[model samples]
Target: MNKRIFSIGLALMLGAAYSLTAFSQVKPETLVKQRQAAMILQGKYWGPLGGMAQGKVPYDATVVARNAGFLEALSKMPWDGFAPSTKDVKSAALPAVFTDTAKFKEAQDRLQSEVSKLVAVSKGGAEAAVKAQLVATGKTCGGCHETFREKQ
Candidate 1:
């Protein structure tokens, strides 16, 4: 009975240690993929609103509000994945993302700030302001991409 209890405890301890190591040492490539996924989702939410601002798509306030809310959430996701480990990973992110750390962080903050403003403005039901904010948000994204992302 004691031997069985000891075996069970040993198995549980080994499982916990393995879980910690697996989660704590996430592969750099995986991190890059996660960040990219977050950015893609951000674009998915932002594209329609951006198109509306650019006159390519018809304006829809309901959609704007929904996407703005989504952007606010997504904007917070990608930054952590730009860890030092990912600096060595081959991705669309430029070297500036790691070398120009302050600028990269500033860009991240700008995106989050702009998205937050968009979320707030969207809730106000002001179409013109929302459209303007969408343009402003797009500019933040473009500015960051110009500095930190490779050209498509």
Candidate 2:
């Protein structure tokens, strides 16, 4: 089989499986917890990568790819847990997250796009390119947080 064809097929199958397993009803607290946990996972990926991007840590191509992959996957999460009921729950999420749904969604899409760019550049082992993409990704995160998250 052609490698490209196989990869496309695998992606479609995985997407279908994920869509099936991702939907469920949970309490407001659970939704808040889930989003928080997902965000923490994102931080784990971003913290080290940000350090490397900012010259605080030495860059490694292998590690950058690994963390970029994690960020790509995590970018798909968290949004699902931003249920309207979760706004007033014990969370850092602001009520505007629900009230400004389209804006919130645009930020999520921007994050996803930036993370995908990071993953693409990380594959090529270009530190400069990856660093630039990392900066873009961080800005996207900040944009969403400023509007949707309460001050900590």
Candidate 3:
């Protein structure tokens, strides 16, 4: 009967919806992928600024402001992905990221703080100050990687 077919279709739809909701919650591999994607984006925004700070790339205020803004936002994206669930996931993060939890958090805070400063400095359009902040931010990144990330 038409009613029976309709009921079956509704049940199937409900089951599919439930399955989607279940899978939408963060999984260990998903968290790892999210953090890695955030890091990759951070690098994409940071590379040019790093080159400028080192005098390899010519500094452009427009690019600096744009990239700094992107960096500031990206900096906050990775920390939650470092959740305990991700500990068993294979990632570029080293054991220290879980073992030295306090240190890892401090490094995350440092990167966020440094990128915030870079965003502020870039808005001022002062080339020297922006470049200086870029170096400082890059060092914050390097310091964290030295302690927490696996070498590529």
Candidate 4:
């Protein structure tokens, strides 16, 4: 009787392990959630950086460089998830994103470029340049969000 119970437990454990492995693979909804979560994290990082740039928070080189670097990294994450096919999935992404791919991609690329500039200025520790780059980066964010993302 004990052996039978042990066997059943082992089988159940193996089954659960297999299920976990299968769930780890990327799916359409998974990609959408991953990108959305990445964007949310980026927004968290943006708050401090924006505060510094807007003079609401004191300038700190370490904080600026770190957050700018994080934003630069995040700038590359959403593109892969925005696959032509994933556009139709249950996401806040608008259908226009698939139809107007070029314009949308251009906006995404522009944000990346601006984020790179922000990273460089942050490293240089130039207050004025960082402020200007922040404005540019914000514009890129607004432009892309307005054009590509849904109103919600």
Q: Write the per-residue lDDT of candidate 2 for residues 104-141, one digit (tens) a residue.
A: 99999999999998888888856777888878888998
Off by over 4 Å in 2: 1-24
**Number of the predicted model whose lDDT against the real structure is largest:** 1
lDDT of each: 0.91, 0.86, 0.89, 0.83
- Per-residue lDDT over 28-101 for candidate 1, one digit per residue giving the tens place of the 0 to 100 score: 99999999999999988888998999989999999999998888889999988999998888999999898999
Cα lDDT of model 4 by residue, 40-98, tens digit: 98889888877876789897778878888999888888777777658769887888888
lDDT of 1: 0.91
Judged by whole-model lDDT over C-alpha atoms, candidate 3 comes out at 0.89
Off by over 4 Å in 1: 1-20
Q: Over 4 Å off in model 3, which ranges? A: 1-24
Candidate 3 residue-wise lDDT, 112-134, digit = tens = 99888888888875788888888
Clashes of each: 0, 0, 0, 0
Q: Rank by TM-score, descending?
A: 1, 3, 2, 4
Per-candidate TM equals 0.86, 0.81, 0.83, 0.77
Candidate 3, residue 81: how far the Cα is off, in Å? 0.7
**TM-score, structure 3 vs. true:** 0.83
TM-score of 1: 0.86
